[model samples]
Target: MENKTTILSLFLIFLFTLPFSAQESYFPPEGEWETKEATAYQLDFAEAIEFAQDNEYSESRDLRQAILKGFQSEPYHKILGPTKKRGGPAGIIIKNGYIVAEWGDTERVDMTFSVTKSFLSTTALLALQQNLITDVNDKAGNYLWDDTFEGPHNSKITWKHLLEQNSDWSGELWGSYDWADRPPSDKNIDEWRERELHEPGTYFKYNDVRVNVLAYSLLNVFRKPLPKVLKEEIMDPIGASTKWRWYGYKDSWTTIDGLKMQSVSGGGHSGGGMFINTRDMARFGLLFMNNGKWEGNQLISEELIKEAVQPSKANTNYGYMWWLNADGPRQWENIDENIFYAAGFGGNFIIVDQKNNLVIVTRWLQPSKIEEFMQILYKNI
Candidate 1:
């Protein structure tokens, strides 16, 4: 009995000692560094391709490797956030421009949050440029709602007001509440005039409800749901996925369905919850990089692109729902200084630097401040 027990113990020890090599990470031993230890790194696209193809990075081997190649030269530097500030998962790089070189989890896709505003602003710009919609100076009240931004059409809001984040509406700001708020729970077109609490364009206050107000204005002018307009005008031209979708209320573009599905209203945002994949976002960035034109066709006129992208009010750098990059130093004081960007809550950023011929797309975790991450990105890139 003692000898039998000894044999059994020996067998158990052997089983415990066996290595389950599968659990170990297998990057080309050279590129593998501690998550926080990145100092300097450069990618050889050709080498990346070879490595991806040879080892198969994700569960997808050959084909997936091909699609993932676009990120090889992407440059995303890592910066630690200050405590509980900026927390996010980001994909960064410089392509056809300066890039963010971090390859976050490849299959990850998160809500774009406020980045949706950039899309909204761009859509309005394109519509106005094509004459599909009127100019920014047009009074939104005259076309869309029955009321002025301050109520009654006496002094209406203009496209400029909406873009500048100064629609001057009496609507309440986002206050931990999206369900029942000004711009009201039960929406009505006729009641719009009475909705004003302030005169239009008096001041700049960041209230996303004003965004919804602007949205209804689009619906009125186009006489169609905002999503369909975006699909035909912007998304299609940019070659974004047919699978892309929006979520919103009945008459808004923010509302949408799912893959193998569809819906029209632009409803969800009062602020964010947009879900888009890396490929689709890359296409969106490409569209902006190409300057509102794709292939040989002019989808969105160049004029609106110029106006919408620049800072709105002279003192403040915010431009028509987009943030101007002018708050910081110029990438080159002498080269050219007109570069700018679109920033979304969390870490989503579409940075356009015309001076350097660079467009950087970074999607990071939001709500949590990511100071460390941004510092790393700006300094390194």
Candidate 2:
């Protein structure tokens, strides 16, 4: 009788702990993802699902038209790389690395504009981790040693400044001028061109030209295509699909070590960036939610991941190309400030809610409705 009682107690303990241990140990294998019913986790996400489905992005499914109409105010704006018709609203909500809910065609690949910046910033962090970049504060010119960073003000720009989008890197790359991108609406072309340049790290501006500079610099450091580095180092290890592709402008090619490689763009502002599926995007969010660890391997250093999300001096709502929920213009009210996300122009988002162990990936959602959607999702969580 005593032996039987001890056996019963052990069985009860095992039954209670089994689910949690399974949740912690499970990592999706290549070409496969695991799913769990929301009720199993005691989560009611019906309201959040309905909200997301109802609030689809109002832009045309034809993204080229949307891009042109959106950036018509900017002079010489043209689609320089590639653009494809986007699919309808899609998303996935992962809890404890298991898909608790998903909607639309999550496998459809689509262009993710500025969200590519976050990936671009990751490559730089990897370079730093590998000692290719001695320090973030070191002058960016020190690495490239070329005409791109030769001018008086341009020489002062650092990797951190570029990552923060405050580099004010004044130049042209792939035929796109620094002054022409999202220039001040209040100023004419000549006025915008001749405006006084702010010192790097002192001002924040979301200029794709400078972003491309960062991509180009990373190409020089890695001595290979950024896409190759990303695939081998991060994506494959996380079990992301092969459907994803990164692109650069048509003419954005350079010869390195006698081999020509394309330096990919940081966003699809002029039509080139990361083209990826929603499921893969969720996997990426899961990786970050786990603090840069995938399975048992630390793919990216936790220190770098923490630093990537830190508020920069120039913008409290901005990190190293990652958007923050800090008290700033872009803050999502009623949301936890610790949350950070990768955002793109066409309403694509990979929100990392580490506090709740949630990774939400939404594509083609109405840009303005994200805050409300997040609030509803948080309530459900």
Candidate 3:
């Protein structure tokens, strides 16, 4: 009787401790994550689904128009690359490492646009951890002595500056003129071209030309392709799908040490960046929400992520290629301030709410409706 009672007590204790222990150690396996209904989280998400459906972009709206407009602007040429048939109203929401909700063709790989910048920034962080380039604030000229970093203005650029999109690098790269990229609608071509250069770290501009310049500099720093670096360090460990592809323009190819290398773009702005499905993006976001740790392994240093999300002095809402929402004048209202996101063109977003242990990947959503979408998701939490 005593032995039986002891066994029963031990079993009860094990049952009591299971949830806590499991919660701390659980991680979805590669390509084999589990899913749960809204009820699993003890929340009604029916209204949330409706809210997401209602906020989706119109199918009839031409997404390529703005891209074409930018392409037809001054000093433009045919952008060389690939663009998949962009699907409509697709998203996936992961709660506590499980798929709580998914909509549209979640498996269809599509262009991720500037969301690639966050990935680009990750490579830089990894390089920092590996001590490849040492300090981010060190002048880019230290590693790159070519024309891209030799000019007085370009020489002042740093890895941090490039990551934050304030490098203001002045030059053409792979046929795209720096001044001609996404020029202000109000400014004439001459005004935009001759605009005074801002000191590297003092100004913020979301220019893809400069972003590509950063990619190029990173290529020189890594002494290899960025995708290979990401694959070995990030994607492979995260168990991301093999279908995703990073692309660069045809002319962007160059030879390095007798090896043919193509430096990928930081966006799909001129067509070519990360083409990944929602599931892989969810894994990437989950990695970040867990503070750069994965499956008990510190994939990226916590200190780097903290600094990565730190609002830049030049732009309060911008970090090291990550968009922040906490304490700025233009903060995302009605949502947790701790949330940060990787935003891209065509309304692709990876909203990371670490506070809730949630990662939401939305593609082709209406940009203006993102705040409301997040708010609705918050209510479900």
Q: Give lDDT per model, in order.
A: 0.50, 0.92, 0.84
Worst 10 residues of 2 by lDDT: 18-27
Mind sharing the TM-score for model 1? 0.60
Q: Across residues 1-381, which tens digit of lDDT does each residue of candidate 1 receive?
A: 999999999988887775422122111111121232122233323322222223222212222232234222222211111111222344544444223244554234544545667777766886687685566788766664444344463257678887786755554322212122233325554464354445556666665556666665665566656667778887776656666555543322222223221222222222222456544565566566657666557776677677777765532557776666555422323223465666654456666654433455655533233333333344533
| Best of the two (1, 3) by lDDT | 3
Off by over 4 Å in 2: 1-25
lDDT of 2 by residue, 1-381 (tens): 999999999998987886563547467898999899999989978898889899998978899999998899999999999998999999999988889999999999999999899999999989999999999999999999579899899989999999999989887899999999999889999999999999888899999999999999999999999999999999999989999999999999999999999999999999989999999999888888888988889989999999999999899999999999999988998999999999999799999988878899999899999999999988856
Pairs clashing within candidate 3: none
- Model 2 residue 337 lDDT score: 96
Report RMSD (Å) for each prediction in the order shown. Answer: 21.0, 3.2, 3.7
Q: Which candidate is the best by TM-score?
A: 2
TM-score of 2: 0.94
Off by over 4 Å in 1: 1-88, 97-102, 105-109, 148-154, 171-199, 250-273, 328-337, 365-375, 378-381
What residue pairs are clashing in model 2? none
Q: Candidate 2: lDDT over CA atoms? A: 0.92
lDDT of 3 by residue, 52-144 (tens): 767776433343555565457646755566666677778888887888888888888888889999998999999999998799899888887
